[model samples]
Target: MTAPRTPILAGNWKMNHGPSQAARFFADFLPLVQPADDRSVVFFPPAVSFAAAREAVQGRPDVRLGVQNVHWEEGGAFTGELSVAMAADAGAELVLVGHSERRHVFGETVDETVRKVGAVLRGGLVPVLCVGETIEERRADRAEAVVVEQLRPVLASISAEQLPTLVIAYEPVWAIGTGVTATPADAAAMHAAVRRTLAEVYGAQAAEGVPVLYGGSVKPDNAAELMSQPGVDGVLVGGASLDPAGFAAIVAAAG
Candidate 1:
C-alpha cells in the first residue's frame, strides 16, 4: 500500500526570537531535522528573522523557511511593514496569514487577510491561512459559523486554482497557548468543515489535495493521534516546538 503523504511539521516562532536567537535556534534545529528525513519541516519566524533564517536553511534541501506575516503591497514606505517581495526575496517559501494574535491583537480583519493571501500567492509564496472560533463562539455552538465566516472573504477574492496552494490551519482560540488542546475528535470536525467548504467552492479535486492542519498546543505526546484524525494533515506547532528535542519528537511521533 502506498504510504500517506509525508506530513509537514511547521513551527512558528512568533515574536520570540530575534535575528541572533534565530541563528542559534536554526543552527541547532537544522542538524536535528535532516532534509531527507524531515523533508516537510518548515519554520515560520517573525518577519525580521527572514534573512537569518534563509542563511540558516541555505544548502539544506529538506528544510524551508517561512515568514509569519507580510504586507499586501509590493512596495512603498510602509514603515514597519514587511512586503511580500521582501519575504520572497528573503527565501521564504510560505507566509502565514490571519494568525489569532494578528486577528485579536493587531485587528486584521477578514477582508485584509484575504488581501494578504492573494498578495502572498501573487508574490510566489504559499499562504498558510489560519482560521478558528474563539472561546465564546465555541461555547455558543458557533464554531462552524465562525470558521466559515473566516473562509468566506479569503476564498471570495481568490481563484479556484489558488485553492490548491493554500493550506488551512484550524486553531481554536481558547486552546492556543493555554496548555489545552482540542481533543482529536474536536479538531477533526472542524477540519472536515473546512474541507467541505473548500469542496463546495473550489471543487473536489482542489479540496481533496489541499492540506488542512490542526494547531493549538500540539505536543510530541499528542501529535500522532491528532494527525491520525480525519482531515488533520499536520500541525502548526507553537511552544512545544521551541525546543529542538521536543520538536523532533513530534515529527518522530508522526511515525
Candidate 2:
C-alpha cells in the first residue's frame, strides 16, 4: 500500500512581513503550533525575510522555509530576480513556482514554470508548482484543461524519481486573495484532476506519493472542512497566514 500523504500547511506571505515583522511573527507563531509527525508547516516568506524566518524556525524540523519566487537562471543582469542556488544558500529548502500572482499579475508562462522547476530540482530544493485557471477560464468551463496544460510540460520534464519530491498546489485564480474560496467540493474535484494528471505522467505509486494542496482564501474558520475533503491534502494560506494565532488555528485544522 502507498503511504499516507502528510498534510502540509504552507503560508505564502506574499509581499508582506519584513525581517523584524517576520521575527516577531515567528516568536509568537512557533509556540502556538505543536510539532507533529503527521503534518508539516512551510513558510514562503519574501526573499528579504528568508534569514529571519529561517532563524525563527531553527531547531524545529516540523517547520520549513521556502522562497516565494526564484529565477531559473543561475546568474545574470536579470536584476531583482533570485536564483534557486541563492534561495538554497539563504536557507530555503522549497521554492514556489508559477503562483497565480506570478502567472496572472506578472505574466509567468508555462515554459517558464518548466525551467524553474528544473532549476529547483537541480539546486536540490523542492518545488511547489501552483496551477489553476483564471475566473474567465473557470467560467468558460476550462478550469481542468487550463490547469492540466500549465502542469503537463513541467510534469513531463521531470524524472519519476524527482516526481515524489514535487508538491502541487491548485489555487484557482478566481478565489485567490479575493475573499472567495473554492468550496471543499470544488477544491476536491480540481485536486482529483491534478492527481489524475500526475498519475498519467508518473505511475499511480509515484502520483499517490505527491501531496496536492488547495490554496485560495483559506482561513481558520473553513480550513477543517476544506481539509476533510478527499484528495485535499492541505492548504496554501494567504492573508490569514499573516497572523500568528489565526495561522496556528489553520495549522490545527490540518492536524
Give lDDT per model, in order. 0.87, 0.93
Q: What would the C-alpha RMSD of candidate 1 be, to one decimal place?
A: 1.9
Backbone collisions counted per model: 0, 0
The estimated TM-scores of all candidates read: 0.94, 0.98
Q: Model 2, stretches more than 4 Å misplaced?
A: none
Off by over 4 Å in 1: 1-5, 37-39
Write the residue-wise lDDT of candidate 1 on 1-255 in tens digits: 324445788999888788888888878776776557633888998877768877878898677788888889888989898888987877889999999999999999988898999999898889999999999999999999999999988888888867768888999999999999999999999999998998888876677877888999999999999999988888999998788778988877666
lDDT of 2: 0.93
Model 1, residue 170: C-alpha shift (Å): 0.6
- lDDT tens readout by residue for model 2, 2-118: 989999999999999999999999999989988888898999998888888998888899999999999999999998999998998888889999999998889898899999999
User: What does the lDDT read for residue 34 in candidate 2?
Assistant: 81
For candidate 2, give the lDDT of residue 59: 87
